[model samples]
Target chain A: MSAGMPFYVSPEQLMKDRADFARKGIARGRAVVVLQYDGGVAFVAENPSRALHKVSEIYDRIAFAAVGKYPEFENLRVAGVRYADLRGYSYDRSDVTARGLANAYAQTLGTVFTQESKPYEVELVVAEVGDTADGDQIYRLTYDGSVGDEHGYVAMGGGAEQIDAGLQQDWRPGMHLADALALAVRQLGADPAGGEPRTLTGDQLEVAVLDRNRPRRRFRRVQGELLTRLLSSEDPTADVPVPDEDDSPRASSTNPQTQRDSERDQDRDVDGGADA
Target chain B: MTAGPESGRLPSAYLVPGSSSFTEFLSAHAPALLPSRRPLPPQATLDAPHGTTIVTVTFRGGVVMAGDRRATMGNIIANRDMEKVFATDEYSLVGIAGTAGLAIELVRLFQVELEHYEKIEGTLMSLEGKANRLASMIRGNLGMAMQGLAVVPMFAGYDLIEDRGRIFSYDVTGGCYEEHDHHSVGSGSLFARGAMKKLYRRDQAAGDAVRVAVEALYDAADDDSATGGPDVGRRIWPTVGVVDAEGARFVTDDEVAGVVEAVIADRRDNPGGAR
Candidate 1:
């Protein structure tokens, strides 16, 4: 009439097992790519949901990108915003840096991994646009709380190794905004299993930038007609379309395919990737 | 600044999914950080410098806001060339009057609130929504307002949906009212409003609207001792901001000086503003 006693697991085994679980959950979702160009940093994610964003502005010059379970990463994103806002409020706006934010995320993720019954299945990238290309900084954080000071480009989530490989071969310093965006889209669409690469349209992809030349707030989304023109433009050095002086954020046009894909992804996120 | 938690993770209040307003977030997590939450001495009204005279005028495509460059204490001028007008965002501007210190703080918080909501929602708040948000923020300052440390701000923006410039004015109790074509606040507002009443015309050009604003400010300074007039010797001029379909920007010093010169030249001839 008694329950069976649980067997003890080694600390190393417990930690490794938690990491694998989190990795599997993250890998079930599509990937997000962050890269640096002459202008600033670009974040490209294969997200079809216009309402639920994968890339967001954290502060004046800093941006946040993530790939994993939507709710978990979204929680972290909101937390990061609060941290940055509070810090800026208390001290000066310049005091809130990506380094401090990354460290905070590292601490939070690390604690949740070690202490919680279930680890948060999320990966994040925080980028700060600098005055010069050399001054730009991009930090990548994994589910297990490890942080990587990435340069040039970094990829995360599903088929990240393959995307990272593609980026390593093609990404170069001082690329124009168009070139950087095209490269990111191309890498994100590349098939990881050695099949034909998918052609992602503007409606299927989410893109934003941390423009260095912009005034106080450097973070701006590149979408709608501007994104389409940039992708299809033949010349790499062509003048990118300048967004209208009207600062209103435009609603993205949705396609049937993207809508269907987003529905499926939403189901997967809610189910916690149990089927995968 | 609040000390970091021992675990180094953000406090639970931050992770709780809630309103996109930064001030709301502060009120929930760190109420002490809010300007209105601070406690003041009982029965004591702090004698703070008060900024004077802000005028706003709406033209065909956009709106113009101007403020005189003076802050006054009880009897003496506290500061000359004090900046009272600020671009709250790319498409909107705000000018503050009363209790210069608290007014500036309120402006800073309002700026953050708008930007924070935009970033979180991935969209700009409508002009009406922005004005309503400002009203709520002012309402939070009612405690401070009761003690004579009030802040009255005039907000003007280019409404994207309406495709025209709009103006909003507020009272100490946070009662927000939409003005038709023009509005003014501060100690010299009466004189400024009289000038605008005579000068404002329907569908005036942006350039004409700017001149009207400067003229109104000039009239205010001429009558009110607290309001500072154009200091030609020091080259200090009124701060002026214009918002249109393109965006909001501060008119250059040189450009404002040219308008001031024209106004002075005209005054020499008539000894009074145009009818």
Candidate 2:
């Protein structure tokens, strides 16, 4: 065929094509939910791999959750950590904020979308637990670097629309940790094709939180018996131990070996009170 | 990862998938930021403040580390209340004794190093791994150490794997030596170690550990002019840190003061400390 006179594709068409490709890639992954509770922010992801994490702590009070290709989002996660650490080192510990990190991620994602060959197929939520409930902030960044300042709750990845709808129907302000976690799991199990919801156990889900009651570094992972108890108990909050100010129990009160064995059994209960 | 256009985007080095080490990243991207990279005058015997007398004693469940509040410049006291003890992370503590300014800067870098690794890898470094990382950091400072500026730090932590408290000491050349029971570093380390040898007991409680550390510092101050004893008049006390299954925390001043008063009162009875 004679070289077709170079047909020009408009900028808008090219951008739309990239966006569609990225969205489709992201939608193939499992869902992640982030919501604000009475004490702090809770992150629940339908991730079964203990070694590979979908949620991580970025700074003193900031956390990150993402859904998409693991390697791609992992790159962004590491980059976010570097930015926060470098900034905190250069300035003060309090200087690192989720908004600043979200802005940096936006810049990187936006640049890559416009400049690189393939856009990153990742959607991220950056949450910071503030001093008060009203002060909590969550920023959602999409493939094209657009930001949404969401309040209360956010869901992303495959079946996100359905999960978001479920969260909207049930999520309320200042729910207990157990109620919040149950709501997230229920929503994550919602079927996109309008089928019956699947039940997710503690092993099948990954959970963590930015506990406002914690002293400086507020991020803590919830797993093992604590996760099961939170999922099964009717009054989980009644006996749920808030992590001490130091993030661990008093050294003199418990035996080291026993503490370690219990912690191993429970995985990581950030509240530091699961065994108690 | 090249030096691309000057834009608001993150440097390629930060985005590149690579090692979890923060210092390594800083070295590759901003070599000037590393404490060991600063160029010093060759063969220069610079007069700088030197912190003295850091002691670490293992209790039943954890470790207690304490440092006297003095930084000396030759015959003069450069700083009366220099903090030489720092909680490196939740489960670890570090006490520095060397060039005061450089040592503090090294501690800061080491703190960031551990924190960066934890955040990147989603787990705390093994106690041995942390000690090795600190060793390499000190090795980097060998360049400055050879020029009469050195940083010697005592590292103590509650090892989850080992299920007990552990201590690690380092030399000027970054040789990491695991010390059992108790250890000390600084200008007055000799005297402090002697006192600890007498007072440190196996399976001591946390309160006993604090007492032993303070007593060790007191004995060091009595013999070494560089070390400072508890200053009751100014209400200045030695900084104490405890690391155990619960994590690391600094002992409150009031608590340290109570110990200091008791030690001083006991010293009034015997010129020399307990045998």
Best by TM-score: 1
The numbered model that scores best in DockQ is: 2
State the number of backbone clashes in model 1.
0
Taking the tens digit of each residue's C-alpha lDDT, what string does model 1 give over A148-208?
9999999999999999999999999998888888898999898989999999999999999
Model 2 C-alpha RMSD to native: 6.6
What candidate 1 gets wrong by more than 4 Å, as runs, is A1-5, A233-276
Worst 10 residues of 1 chain A by lDDT: A251-260
Model 2 lDDT, full chain set: 0.86
TM-score of each: 0.91, 0.90
In model 1, state the lDDT of residue B129. Answer: 93
lDDT of 2 by residue, A154-194 (tens): 99999899899999999999898899999999998878898
Itemize residue pairs with steric clashes in candidate 1.
none
